[model samples]
Target: MKTAIVGAGAMGQLFGARLQLAGTDVVFLDTNQATIDVLNARGVTLQTESRTEHTPARAARASELDETFDLFIIFTKGFHTQAAVASIAHLIGAESCGLTLQNGLGNAERLQEYFGPSKTLLGVTDFPADLSAPGMVSSNSRGKVRLGALGNVPRLPNIAQLLDSADLHAAVEQDIRIPVWEKVAFNAALNTLSAVTGLTVGGIGADPHARGLVASVLEETLAVAGRLQIDVSRQRIEAALDNAFAHHTHHKTSMLMDREAGRPTEIDTIGGAVVRLGQDNGVSTPVLATLCELVRTAARPGDNR
Candidate 1:
């Protein structure tokens, strides 16, 4: 399969590199000229805990891309979804499948807007990675992705096999929206708190006050999910939080990384989405609202205070 991964960020590079090593023809579409130049010139060095491999890469901007792609894997930030798709819409072929392996909610809708509802596969991943340098990426821990067609799509299996070839465990899910909600709820609790407080996941997990804050936001999310008849539980999400404290204590979430990089976060997609859903469903989300406000304020550009 000829695959195009948008957004040459950590996850994008990681997926592209692994897919390339697995002998899939992988190319990246990014607006960043510097990253494109580096990828096309030196390729990438992919390092995991157990092994390291050199993977050749190809990249092009939307304007430079002249070939059709079979698979379009979106790894861009949630906020950039629309622009990213617009940039490369011309590359999507009649038989093409679009997959979003990004964080947070509404990705399916964004992808479907351009790629068609049935042709879009929405998924989530926890494969933690960092772009060490221009052409260097490191996957800190092993993780797989769960993908499900937004509607009855025939090419779903083909998309899954494409990732399977790359050794990326892209499991097909019958009901993916629930998991997407659960993951976003988890992020609303952990990512927002860590981003606002400048604390590691462990720091927030260990603090009683922070735990209360997490509970508040989580309960609100659960309430919203319940109203929609989604089978998400406070117990399930809370247990995941406890497990995260134990296993991912040292890990910084994507939101925290964005803050450190001075990049805008997907607070709107996670926390902000929670609050919006609550309002839409007539459920109140005071905790998420406050956290969203604080995060947006902190992320404002050129703020000296």
Candidate 2:
């Protein structure tokens, strides 16, 4: 398949490189000139716990490409979803599928505006990727992707097959919302708390007070999910949390990374989205709401204080 990996960030490079190495034609679509140039020049370098691999890459801005794509795997931040999808409108043919494995909610809706519901795919991934440099990504081989179509589409399994061929460990889910909400709950707790307190996964788990905050956020988010009838699994989410806290102790969440770099975090889509849903469903989420505001204030640009 001719694939376009949008965003060219850490996760983007990780997936693109793997697919390219698996013999799929992969091109990276990104707005950053430095990232585009580096990808085109040095390709992508992926480092994992076992080994490191390199794959030659092609990258360009949307305006620079004229070929239609078979699939578009979106990895852009939540705030940039609309603009990013709109920029690639010319490349989305009738048969093309747009998949958003990005964190947070509402990304699939933005894609649906361009690709339509039938051609849009929504999913979640726990794959942790860190961009050490423009074309260098570090990650562990310990994550899987769960995705499904927004509307009935027979070819959805083929998309999953394509990812599996690249060893992405993907599966087409019957109800994608469940996993998506569960992931949102997990991120709303860990990501927000870590961003606000500069705590690593283990640090939060180690501190009783921080751990209490995490539990409160998780509970509030799960309540919001329950009101929506999403049936997100609390036991599964708690087990995932326990695993992360014990094993991935030194790991810094994407939100914390963005905060430390003074870049905008995905608080709006992750934490803020849950709070909005809670309010709509008459479920109070005071803890998540407060953390959302705190993350926003902490990540504001040019804050010298």
Candidate 3:
């Protein structure tokens, strides 16, 4: 399949390199001239815990795209979702599909708005990815992408098959809402804490005060999820949070990375979304509510967080 990776940041480079290594015709789409120049010149380097692999790559700006593609996988940050997709919507052919493995809520909705349910796929990756440098990316995504169709659209076997052929470890979920919420809740719980406290994942897990605050956020989010009947389990979110805290103690969350870079974190999409759902569901999310304000306040003015 001819695939284009929108938002070829860390995760983009990781997936793009792997797909190309596996023999798929993959190209990158990014707004950064440096990223495009680096990719077009020497391709990308993907580093893992074990070893590294280099893959030849191609890239172009969205406006420079002159052809349609079979698939577009969005890895852009939450705030850039709308504009990113809109800029590249011309590349999505009639039979083509768009998949978003992005973090936070509303991404699926955004993709659906642009591509429609029948042409949209929702996916989530557990792979921890970091863009160590402009042309270098690292990830733990050794296998498997959890994917599902949106709304009542019939499962597209071709999408999963193509990813599997590229050795991306594709697995289809009948109802992907479960994993979506699970991941969102996990991010909502700890990412904000890491950003606000200036601590690593492990530090948040170790601190009694931080852990207590995280637990409150989790409870409030789960309550809201339950009310929405999203099939999110408290036990599941707790287990995932515990697992991350224990294993990735020193790891910095995406939110913390954004905060440090003075970029807009997905604070509203992750934490603020929880608070909004809580209010709509008649559930009080005081902890999440406070987190939303604090995080927003902490964002620098020039960044438009």
Worst 10 residues of 1 by lDDT: 296-305
Instruction: Please identify model 2 stretches exceeding 4 Å from their true place.
Output: 302-305
Off by over 4 Å in 1: 302-305
Q: Considering TM-score, where higher is better, how would the candidates rank from best to worst?
A: 2, 3, 1
Worst 10 residues of 2 by lDDT: 296-305
Off by over 4 Å in 3: 141-143
Please write out the lDDT profile of model 1 over residues 158-179, one tens digit for every residue.
8788777787877888888788
**Model 2 C-alpha lDDT per residue in residues 141-173, reported as the tens digit of each score:** 878899897688667899999998888999989
On lDDT, the stronger of 2 and 3 is: 2
Give the Cα error of residue 53 in candidate 3, in Å: 2.1
Instruction: Kindly list the per-residue Cα lDDT of model 3 for residues 188-209, writing each as its tens digit.
Output: 9888888888899999989999
Return model 1's CA RMSD, one decimal: 2.1
Give Cα distance to truth, residue 101, candidate 3, Å. 0.3
The TM-scores, one per candidate, come to 0.94, 0.96, 0.95
Q: What is the lDDT of residue 244 in candidate 3?
A: 81
